[model samples]
Target: MISRSSQTAAIAFAVLILLLSASIGNAYEDVGVSISIKGTRSYKLKKEAQLLAKKQAIISYLKRVNPSAVGKSCAKQLVNDRAALIKRITTQEISQVGDYMEGSYLVRIDDEKLNYMLEELGCGAQNGATDVTILIMEEPPTKANISMILNPEDSTGVRKLRGLGPFAVFYTSYQRSIRDTIISKANKEGLKLTRLDTFDEFQKMRMSNDDPLVGVYFDDESEDFVINKRLLKVVRTRFAAQNTIVLYYRIESLYFDQVTRELNAAIAISLYDLNSGETKSVGSQDFMVIVPKGQSSVAIRDGLAEVASNAASLLMNQAKKQIRRMASIAQVHAQKKGTLPVTVTVHLKSKRTMYNVKKNLKPSMIRHSEIKGDSLILKLTKGIQADDFVYGELLGVLEGMGIKIPENNINLNGQEVIIQQ
Candidate 1:
């Protein structure tokens, strides 16, 4: 022990052990995996196949350095942080088979991240629940970019009703109904329903589409991440789990015939493969109603509201299968990439307020007329009943916005309510 040569030999042995440990800590292995998923022609199949390959590869990598973590209750944790794990994964030799869209892939996961994934799983810390937030798109879609991504049909005035406002009573009630059903269904699926804290901000930016049939879609890969990164940035800032899911929905279109008293409407929902910024799936359903020939307008209105609202919920049930599958893919891809219009009467301000009056006053007024300043011509079908309904609605809107007008200042007419400036 006292000799210099002996001391040097001991020191060398210690350094070698340190080097070996470091090497061990950084050990990784490439995995060859084959998978075939059943689906129509869609990138969704490819994405699913890749996730399977990566999962196999991750397990394979852990088998080499940390065999103890090979099997465990790691699923919950995986669902939550799969995005970061996905970022650490690499794929190659991807080949596709016919209509099945089957594929085999060579997959690899980063050593450090692999260890982290396993460690987190082993600790049982992550609840592994996916956070799901649901939002209804704002009508008229504040931004021009929305039309750029929406299908041509979605962009048509017949579908979008651009420059027109939807009836708040009709749409918001349907939205609330759908929202409640979505939550109840999601709860059954065991997903952790966390708030999509950034969604409101996202809507304000108008990067999303209001068309229920469209939802939010990005055709270009670059733009996908650009939009996703905004959400991810919020996730990071708020320390949200990486795999939060958002569902965007809206009433696609609705029509009513005054003479026949028949109603027809459709609603749609769209989901995306967030990492790639591509549409994963879109689901829509139509509902129709024939109001009883002699029913009061109030009864017809209430019945229509109930039918539209309940139809959207029923459609959610019909689309539940697709939604669940999309949510699953959403979970897998989530780890891969890393992560609002209220028309309130503003003191009954401009001629613009007439849009609200017509939409709220008489349903036909909204659909058939291009309302202009102080020039409303009441249809013979709309009478005292319509005026009472519209007047009450106008008062509610003003009060809702925290706006007040003394009766003395309110110059109310049969179809107009203008506040004195």
Candidate 2:
């Protein structure tokens, strides 16, 4: 019995020793293995790993070391030297995971080790166990998952702003700039930013349903600010209309020809709405032109060239009627007290000795013609000389009209004349 008891005690002691050894080995113990990156792109590993570390809440230690002359020579000995080191290192790391150790772990990582390892494996370890805390984080969320919405109250002044004629472009560009500025400010103000792939989706979101959190998105500092569709639509419609007007009416060149009668040479005529998409017609009459022929090319080009000036006077007389009809149809009011211009003013003169004198005078010399009343009017043109001949004709016309022609009353070469009484 004593021999058997001694044998049992020895076995028990051996078992305890084994357990104690195992526990001691495990206490304050860690296993770490070095990674040898391969290839020239190894420099990229540190950056990628750093990013991965931050994302995964892991700490990475990078040590700087100059290339060893001997190691460098050995590595340069063959094309696959770097590859061999990478294989060795990887294999060691993998096989050593379950290794039993009694001291703190260490992973000697340098730029060179990274290069050698990477040359063997094009990509770094994707998912695996490392002796150290090596964490590779998952990618961040994409912009497509987020939503945007425009607000309605924000859309009020947009249309009117877009109506400022040529200034509309500046406004549009300014709006984009302002939005970007707001986003940048938001970023500086500590707001998160995200980018959406398409702006069309942004334009479609409703007011209350979309997210209102503003963010920086895409490559630019655009307000990934969410807004309601109604608001966006208001701004979009006005801007679109303004752009349409600009594009449709943007004429690269314009030319005009005038049709005129001798009596109406001095009148100014032009096409008012030339090259506009709304007025597709090529005739000046389409644009309501009523100037004398050849007065301005704008009239014909603007589709208003066809309106006759002679007949325009008649139209002017009935202006109130036309405007009233237009106003009623257009649902807009016409301001009262608008007066139409008189196109023609007629004058009558008595045919007598005075009329002959005035009529016979050269165009260079001013002359007056007698009217039914004892009055005279001067007829004038270019190149008229102020002289006695012009005055004599005027004096005769005044006397013939039964007005006393004072010597002072007849001014030579006068553009206008008055009969003396």
Candidate 3:
């Protein structure tokens, strides 16, 4: 028979071991893994990195919880088959915890959900060890705000002017300096700048484009006293139906003020939305140099630079207001229905037609889309009964890309829209 003192000591030791095991299991419940990958700063790249980080974190958690099942061999296999594994896993709940550091990201995965996924993939623990719960905490995904700046090319062409009219044109001499300043300011304000020479380039760039809450087009060329009605009409027809909010700026006049005996410069500013197809004047301000009567040309140039800076500041403030309004609309829509599905069917002409179409649509707006030979079935996210906005935007994009869709060939049935070339 065992001695009573010995029995008590054995029980105490067993209890302590159990307690330690519980503590260890609890420690492995939540896991955070840091991932560093070199890639361009883009929505697609960030999303891919996020998925990869999540996969790494989940694998790490699995290894900690069940070393035997998720050992070196399993880890190697998971890494090799990550592309397939990523499709099976859902990351709607998983959150990226911090800002990307030197292209590195911290990803947190819920232990329970991860284990479930692993088991579903036939990579569960050998002995059904299930005591891990450590998960990285992260803020929920929120709506994104974006802004863009467009720079006009010096050379002119039918395609070029077609792409850049109504927006201010840049003077060849100071275009680079002004562009650099705008970029710097936009960077400080967390805005995205799309540097393009022409609207044709803009169309090509739009395929994988970010949705801009505000678009500021810089045109610094001196405007003619008489507006060209024919040119303006053509521009209106081409770019009038865009859904983006755009601010256009141009130098109206620059001359020596005879009465004030000073150099005077005026810039015309306008704000318009392609959605509404109207260009409303934002403001026109004159900058004057009232110092010495005989100022050097350099002094006049300096004065112009100052005026340009002031115009940029005013434009940015107006852009912010537009962004706020857009945000409010989005918030209201989100409250009503977080997302509504709209199906789009497009007739295909060539093999690359669908490819081009996919490139132009915003990725965030697309919930799911599939191309079936000559036809594309696109499921988009938007507000309920907002088909007009969707169809109008699509029409504008299609028109910009030189794709023709006859009015009679277009059809809308409830949430589904069909367009034939």
Best by lDDT: 3
Model 2: lDDT of residue 142: 25
Q: Estimate the TM-score of every prediction.
A: 0.34, 0.14, 0.33
Candidates' RMSD to native? 28.8, 40.5, 26.4
lDDT tens string, model 3, 1-421? Answer: 7567656654553454344323321101334555555554567766776667767765664445444445545566656655543433333333334543223444433333344444455444311221111110011111111000122332244333332232223233233343444444433333333343334423432211331111222222532223333333333333221123344555555444334544444545554544344455656555444434344334445444544444444444344334324323322333343235666767657658777887888777777777765566677776534365356577777888898777776766445566667
| Candidate 2 TM-score, C-alpha based | 0.14
Clashes of each: 3, 37, 11
TM-score preference between candidates 1 and 3, better one: 1
Best by TM-score: 1
lDDT of 1 by residue, 315-418 (tens): 55444434445544543333342221111112334455545545655353232444333333233223333344335654565465465656664433322333
Q: After superposition, how far is residue 132 of candidate 2 from its true place, in Å?
A: 99
- The deviation in Å at residue 247 for candidate 2 is 52
What is the alpha-carbon lDDT of model 2 when measured against the actual structure?
0.26
lDDT of each: 0.43, 0.26, 0.44
The lDDT ranking, best first, is 3, 1, 2
